[model samples]
Target: MTKIAVLGAGSWGTALANTAAENGHDVRLWTHNLNQVEEINQQHTNSKYLPHATLVDTLVATNDMFLAIENVEIVLSVVPTKAVREVAKKLATALEEQAHTVILAHATKGLEQGSYKRISEMIAEEVPEAYRSALVVISGPSHAEDVIKHDLTAVSIGSSDESAAKLLQKALSNETFRAYTNHDLLGSELFAALKNIVAIASGALIGLGYGVNAQAALLTRSLVEMRDLGAAMGAKPETLYELAGIGDLIVTGMSPNSRNYRAGLGLGKGKSLQQVTEEMGMVIEGVNTTKAVYDFSKMYHVDMPITSAVYQVLYENKPLRTAVADLMARPLKSED
Candidate 1:
């Protein structure tokens, strides 16, 4: 069994830690929250984020960043996008000696706003460049709750290093969980990050009492937008059709449990962005990703009418009806 370290005590992190333990690895889950560490260690539960089930008895929790990093062969980072750099800096500081020996897999999905860099690129910047060679992106449609329940799930392990991706596949793959490898690291992360924006759009439709037709339209258009933006950013066009793309978009857009979807529902119900954020209490990644993608779309000269509409509604305080009208009035173009 390999030694696995999971940073972040959030639902996804806890669930992944459980998966690693169930895979018979020695699991060390790290969090900044001492109370959460204590809860995981004492009660085998992460009450705030994942209250539905208990963790494996073999799973270990620690507030010490070094303890979490020390001796682990692979580190899985499941923190939010914004925290990726800060956590990597901390990990870097803690693992000056062990950096080369470890493989780092980041599961968070979002782009850095100004740089428009994928999270993998952000990690490449924050962590030592030498360690960047070992960086891999772990992503798919697997939700934390479903994964913990042992529902069948598949993920893509993207890296320039095929061996590193294969290593993760061996470490993470199981009867209920499978891992696929790809060299499209940036493309994988791009769709994964951008889809949350579309999910918010879907939730907004539901909140606005739009029917399935509206949801379907939103999903289709968003897929196009996602592909267009990804293409502009150097991602393969076909990558948008894969699990990290259409597959992820479908699940997040439809599920009530999706934090971004719930946030969009609030907007659809006529709540302010601040109000929705306050109510969710969890990080609604779509809010930030929408802002990032808006800038990206403009910078890349990509046409994303649906994303533009949502951005206007959220940031410019344009009425939802007005945004819809604006979208409807856009010039017609080929559906290619």
Candidate 2:
């Protein structure tokens, strides 16, 4: 059995850890919360994050960061975007003297707030070559709640190192869980980050009482935006349309299970950003990614109107309906 260390205990992290454990892997699910360590060990449930979901008995949880990674074959980084650097730095210290390189697979999706760097870039900055053989991104439409239930889930795993992706693919795939290996690492990561913005826009439109037609339009147009931006940023064309891009976008935007979509819904229903966040009690990737993508668009001259609208609604206090109006009134261009 492969030894797997999951560096986070949130819903997604816990769910993934459970999957590896059920597959008979030696898995260590780590969380900074000591109380969480006790809960997962004694109760096999993470009520704080996945109240309705039950974890496997073998999926052990830990509070000690170093212990989790000791002699593990795979390290899954599932923490939020803000914690990526801190976690990597700590892991680097832990793996400093390690002779063997561990595969670093990140499921966290979003860009750094100011620099707009992706999670892999952040991990590379802190976790040097001696620690990790490669950085793999495991991302797609899979939701934590559904995954824990063993509902059919398909995800794309991409890495600069193809062998690492294949290794992780075999480690993660099962009857209910399917993983496809991808070579377009940049495209996979770019769409994974940008799609959250579209989800916010989708949720906002729905919250504003718009119908399915509007959602169809938003999905289509926002895809164009995602594609154009990804293209300019060196993403592969097909990757933007594959499971990592459109697949994830559809699920996150359509499902109420998505925190980013729910956040947009709250804003659309006239709740302030603070109120929405306080109500959700979790980090909404779209909210943070919105600001980063908005800034990156300007700096790179990528035209992203919907993302700008989301930024305005979330940060500038622009009315949801007003933002929608502005989008509808934008000068029409060729669909090419």
How badly does each model clash, as a count of residue pairs? 0, 0
For all predictions, the C-alpha RMSD in Å is 1.5, 1.1
Candidate 1, residues 217-249: lDDT per residue as tens digits?
889988888888888989877778878778788
Window of ten residues with lowest summed lDDT in model 1: 124-133
**lDDT score, residue 256, model 1?**
86
Candidate 2 local distance difference test against the native: 0.90
Please, what is the TM-score per model?
Answer: 0.96, 0.98
lDDT of 2 by residue, 1-336 (tens): 899999999999999899989988999998999999999999999999999777899988998878898999899999999999999888888888555579999999898888889999999999888778888999899999999999999999988789999988888889999999899888888899998998888888888899889988999889988987887889999998789999999999888999998988888788888999999999998888989888878877988898899899888988889989999999988988
Q: Note the Cα lDDT for every prediction shown.
A: 0.85, 0.90
Please give the RMSD of candidate 2 to the true structure: 1.1
